[model samples]
Target: MSLSKLLTVCVIAISLNSTAAEHSRTIDIDSKVVSNHRATINGERINYSVTSGTQPVWNEEGEPTATLYYNYYKKDKVDDISKRPLLISFNGGPGSASVWMHIAYTGPRILKIDDEGYPMQPYGMKDNPHSVLDVADIVFVNPVKTGYSRILPNKDGKMPSADEQKAQFFGVNADIKYLADWINTFITRNNRSLSPKFLIGESYGTVRVSGLAKELQQAHWWFLNGVVLVSPTDIGIKRDGPVKAANRLPYFAATAWHHKALPTQLQQKDLNEVLAEVEAFTINQYLPALAKGAFISPSEQQEIAQRVAHYSGLSKAFVMRSNLDVSNNAFWKELLRDKGYILGRLDSRYLGIDKKETGDKPDYYPELSAWLHAFTPAINHYLREELNYKTDIQYKMLANVYPWDRSKNNTGEQLREAMAENPYLNVLVQAGYYDGATNYFDAKYTMWQLDPSGKMRDRLSFKGYRSGHMMYLRKEDLKTSNDDLREFIKASLKSQTHSAKY
Candidate 1:
């Protein structure tokens, strides 16, 4: 071969090798600086800056291992970070992105939805009237595998192994480890270490908070002032236990009344009144009948089944078929079978049209579907148009991170432990009565189990909303919940006596 031709072939081979070894740049850790903007909250005009990018996750050796995508809002001109309150928030999907909390409720602008939470046309966002930004600086965290976050290569220049990814951030323990570290680093880097810090978690986000709280205390020693849990799931609740069914009964009753599935007489009463009756029936009659299990006499079981049907708005025959235990899916499907609409599991108020109305389960949850359709598009638009983030990666609304190890998932117990460890740390649990997924009663059961002796129980608080899982989607619930949350933050910070065994 000629010398020129040989040289050309060698250069071509070198180019191919370089291209083959190259990977996409996963995280720009130094992209900390962001754009500043302003918005009106309540009657106050607040200037805020939005940082929408990825933050680096490092190993103990200070080696970058993963990237955590985040969208943070900081109230400007607060010269001293300690004087203001800082809230680090995320949504629960286990696989979910933080967009639910970011665009739906807490952010400056929110997707427009009706009082019933049904999406409206034109698919745009408006200034959030109930935004909590006026009071607290918010940081929305999208855990690894959600949103634009992904497991990055280590400092050794080797890509992440599946085992390393799972060991670092996929399961309960690992998620807490990295998230707790992310939060600590975020606060410290922003010069907000002395700032009153709080965690606001929705859905599985609450589960993350439970474990993350304890991790924050033990690993980082970064004490939190308070935590707000929306739709909590107690860790280690036996999935097959009677408690899960019993906890669901009240929610069924509430949903039945909403859809007029209950007896006509029960429908005539106010919501609180109807729920009061349902709560009574669940605890007084249904619970004991379920507890009896096979020991329940056939005659008494018939009577209890009839009573459950009356409260739950299902037929006596259908209730009996469930063997005195009606799962949420069955109830949602059966409640309006004749109406040709299946109820949503998350928010039973929203109705779905199943392909065939007789299915044992719904094809889709209408309420979550509505929220997803509305928010997903709005966020995609906002992230690029408003936040000025430039990325072509497919943003994850919910990533399927499977084989989620549940062994380390002891969220309720962890919350109790954190409370025990930090006497001043308070917890505010907010639940939606219409939420069938994480029933309010189940949350009550879990929170009750937090402190058996009721010694530090005073640190815990509970409030119910008129909406579903994403309570703020409803107009009235948004106002009420935000007001409640504002006062909660105040009370938690105000009560920092530094000696409160209270």
Candidate 2:
């Protein structure tokens, strides 16, 4: 062969090798940063260690598919590792980060918000004096695309298509499946297999954890001591037509009473007292009236409208025009419309201003904006400055996980099954009366429908707060809710001789 031709072939081989090396370059997915911290919770000093890290999620072929970021807090001095309960916490949104509960509810650090959860200036964090870390070790997890968690490129540096990602991580069932696997891996890695485990989820996290309760037990052979649902979702328990419409009355009454917009009689009564009357009316009169539809006599419909208006702070004429079925957005917009204000969807306690008062809903979520303003800075500062988990990557507080598959959401039944199979598992539901999105009444209704036979009624309990969805954001509720959680955890601890069978 000619010398020039041989040289050309060698150069071509070198170029191909370079291209292959670029494609084969692997990204680091597993890492950790440990730090120690001390905080005074419930008037007692507690020392704890925090492990902030990213754990890899593997595919069926054992290839790393995604990386999940988590912050695990363990009490510094523990006598028995098994005695120390491990609590896995998650927030909702299907795409939302675990930051809400991590910073505001269960974690040792809290955002600097005012008494009623309004954002305070100098956006930062303070020692959460009510955190449950004193009783149980806690781990806050951020699923794919949330927080710093992300899906990685393939070995060939090719990314998974949107469809593939959804099939693996974006749906209700897929979410539970992978999260169950991730949690099992986390437990094994942390050596907490023998410890009594608990799952606490807020908002949509309730759905995630309710499903997790069963998934962990059935698929992973891991049983939990308790499951805490904070501001829970419907959990796949159906509530359509009249049932759904009627359930909104109690929440309306609560929000109206909060805004001082209720009738004089209700305004003068205590919150719980007014709610009792409204709830009774909702179940007895309102639901039947709604179920009757347009077939009912006009006089009877008028009377029902009057009562609904009385409870909802909406005009009788408006309620009548709505055909006695008011939507949440319509109510939020119409409740304070005359006053040139709009009630917040998540927390009606907060007022918002819209471009015009003529819309059916507010232009944006006021409560959410306030939360992001407070939480974004606090989390960014705390995770990097305090916890020392350094990364230039933008911490996604809420990412785009749209095209989210919501089908086959039988999580309520899944939870019921978990309870039936594991007598050790007890469920605690916490909700805020004023949370319009996942109203307290709906949470109660879900609990009632979760077990049709009512066989597990004794194992389920619900707590109502005076605040909004993230009830723990309220100063009073922050302490009270955490106390409630602490009590539930302690009560759920099984005796050494406790049997799995009933």
Candidate 3:
């Protein structure tokens, strides 16, 4: 569907939902399990059923508050459902849908995009050659206010107030608790309680799962076998803090190198070599100088400024003008200012016109700003058409589910806690080198911070891709990442088996 048509449909959907609300019927959710469907992935045929619907979320007093929507694909003919490992997946938006990681990445049918992940002409779905469905049953979940999920209004068919909404499902800890309940409910309802469980989260979803792992175990005694984090962003996305600029330096270096905007010497070397030098400089020189604030000498400051400009694609004067406090957003604008174009925040490979190039930050993120054009519609098509599920509720691809509470929800600490609590639990950290959002080095730093003792370190694995946030959209990265995920699951399952024997 075209953008205009999709918007029209959304208008219709909202009208229909509003009309339906007039009837004031109590929400009684029944899992809408669709019939089995067949797909050929990895050159092999597999049969799976799609369950697309919402689960009514109620308060402790049994008052309906919200409806959490989810999509699931379970492999058919598994001799023992208990032995079949289940992977529950979600994408992080606090307001974004699960579609990014669902139809775009791990689902049996993936949306067809260009070689570099741009929307393809005659956009449609196809069997994912690299889908991990051959190995595990997957559930793609959308939290309240995202995808088909929504907050249930009062008996008068009116939406709840903002504070009431947050009280039910908006804040960090609030989100984890409800999601944990939904997971357990799904497991119990599907009779897969014995299945080894895994979690797959992308971007902010990583933060969600990190805290979720601990919440599941601590609150419900639900232990997860493993976790797969794509473009991990455990720490918050703030960029103006003391060390934040320094933390973002490696990413700037990577983006500059990818765009060939760096100095000739750095550009000529391999990306890893360039990254190694930048990492050393970030830790040894840049960070210390930045830490000095106004105490450092001009000569030393000039030295730092020169090297920062050399590594980053910005001018020395520009770098020094900001007192060496350059951020990822500034780099995005400055690096491509001369070209009258803006580079993408998620992937520097994508370019967009910035209206006029006189700005500190890019006019918009080309990669995600135009996402609604393709991704939103594609997901709506897949859900209503292919899955045989019908819904008139306008799917919330992304909403302003704010003010997003960025409290002391240290999810990295939660991840470490889960690992410590569940010895059998392992983790797979996957990062995209070109992912300007959750840079590779920051992910490394998060993992390093998690494993201070190195004993649980062996269980932690890492993989870096040449793509961006939704790395699997890249054809090669898709295949390679699926292969990696297959191996990781196998190793984790084996590790679980070994731990069982002991």
Candidate 4:
């Protein structure tokens, strides 16, 4: 049916409660038996689930569509929901899914990896003794067109185009609207509005959370207790701008030089200290070199080229010829070409053997994708066999129908303006040092654009980990991250409660 027709039908079929008129319907999700198996993790019996819940979906135009499914997990007692904070978690790709975080990090079941950080054969799954779900009720959401989310066909049975898909499903407005509906329905159904709510978003999901915070408050008057942004993306879209591009150079230098991949090094200094010098060079000299073009002096250009090569682990001649504007792709391939390996765009620390090893564009990290399959089996086993949840629909873990609406009209300035005006909302951004794709420094610059007041500034906290995009993949980092999350949530909730008292 057409979206308009769907809206008409939904309006007739669904009646909103007076308390939540903005939300369409209440979805009563029955608890299912997911898994019954027990595993000892850190000497404790860890039980898990791969159960699902349905939420009413609305089109980008505020029209109701089909119901959405989410994978949920809790430690042991479903009735003991009071002890646990509600956590709505999501992954990014604008096209990615939530399977990684669900299985690898916070879920009760975790995928196993070898000592070298590679997936082991006969892949083993284990109880996540470190699961934060012990403290929170975790619900993993798959945005539209990801995981099992599909667009209902029109009466004429035609599918939407890429543009239409984005306009109707994936854009910022659409995400916020859908999330508002989903959260409201969930709270109403569970009767947990007083319980603290939290959101955790990985990569582009950070963008989603930032907008959703405001959307939820404005549309539903629901404020989140806290938000966790893992491997955050720069809200600014201009990837090629001199200042923006130059800012990322330090991260590249840090990752490359930290690995001793760089050809030349002044000394064995702290990674942050060395990266500071690289950042200075990038802003003061390298950016100027790129702007000077052919008019720049040969000696000066060569000096800059040598510095870039020294810090980036690329050859001096190659750096000189490229005019020091080396793209991320070239850096990945060129850095370890002699070893016949390429680093991952998502996590440069990971190295795969060759393209044949994984049939991927870059050879070194196909295991990252392979690990997803390993996780799926475990999540299914845990949810079905352990937690005792049974469902027919395939759990939609990830989806690619994320809206990347980066039109010229959607400027960073506009997003900044929105944030500045809404000073009550705070952001907690965490980035991995080894993530070359969305560099930590890039996020720093993006934060500068936000006109936060003193109070709002206190609300914003940025954390950097000596890891990659999926920092939680590292056991130690995951623990630290969970602690960080717990503290942030407690503080935010306290602040909110205190403010309301006044």
After the best TM-score superposition of candidate 3, give how far the Cα of residue 291 lies from its true spot, in angstroms. 1.6
lDDT of 3 by residue, 305-395 (tens): 9999998888999999999998777888889788787789888878888778898888778898655666877888888888877766678
Off by over 4 Å in 4: 1-51, 58-64, 74-84, 153-166, 236-239, 263-267, 288-297, 353-367, 389-404, 408-424, 452-455, 500-502
List the global CA lDDT of all models: 0.83, 0.92, 0.83, 0.66
Alpha-carbon shift of residue 20 in model 3 (angstroms): 6.4
Model 2 alpha-carbon miss at residue 457, Å? 1.1
lDDT of 4 at 278: 82
Clashes of each: 2, 0, 1, 26
Question: What value does the lDDT take at residue 213 in candidate 1?
Answer: 81
Q: Which of the two, 1 or 4, has more lDDT?
A: 1
- Model 4, 140-177: lDDT tens digits are 88776565455654545565677776766676666656
| Number of the predicted model whose lDDT against the real structure is largest | 2
Question: After superposition, which runs of candidate 3 have C-alpha atoms over 4 Å from their true positions?
Answer: 1-28, 154-159, 235-240, 500-502
Show model 1 residue runs off by greater than 4 Å: 1-25, 237-240, 497-502
Deviation in Å, model 1, residue 67 alpha carbon: 1.0
Tens digits of lDDT, candidate 2, 1-502: 8999999999999999998876653334999999998999878899899999999999989999999999999998798998899999999998999999999998888999999999989889888888998899999999999999999988898999999999999999999999999999999999999999999999999999999999999999999999999999899998999999999999999999999999898899999999999999999999999999879899999999999999988999999999999999999899899998888889989888999989787887789889898999999999999999988678999999989999999999999999999888999999999999999999999988888898788888999999999998899999999999999998888443677776
* Candidate numbers sorted by TM-score from highest down: 2, 1, 3, 4
lDDT of 1: 0.83
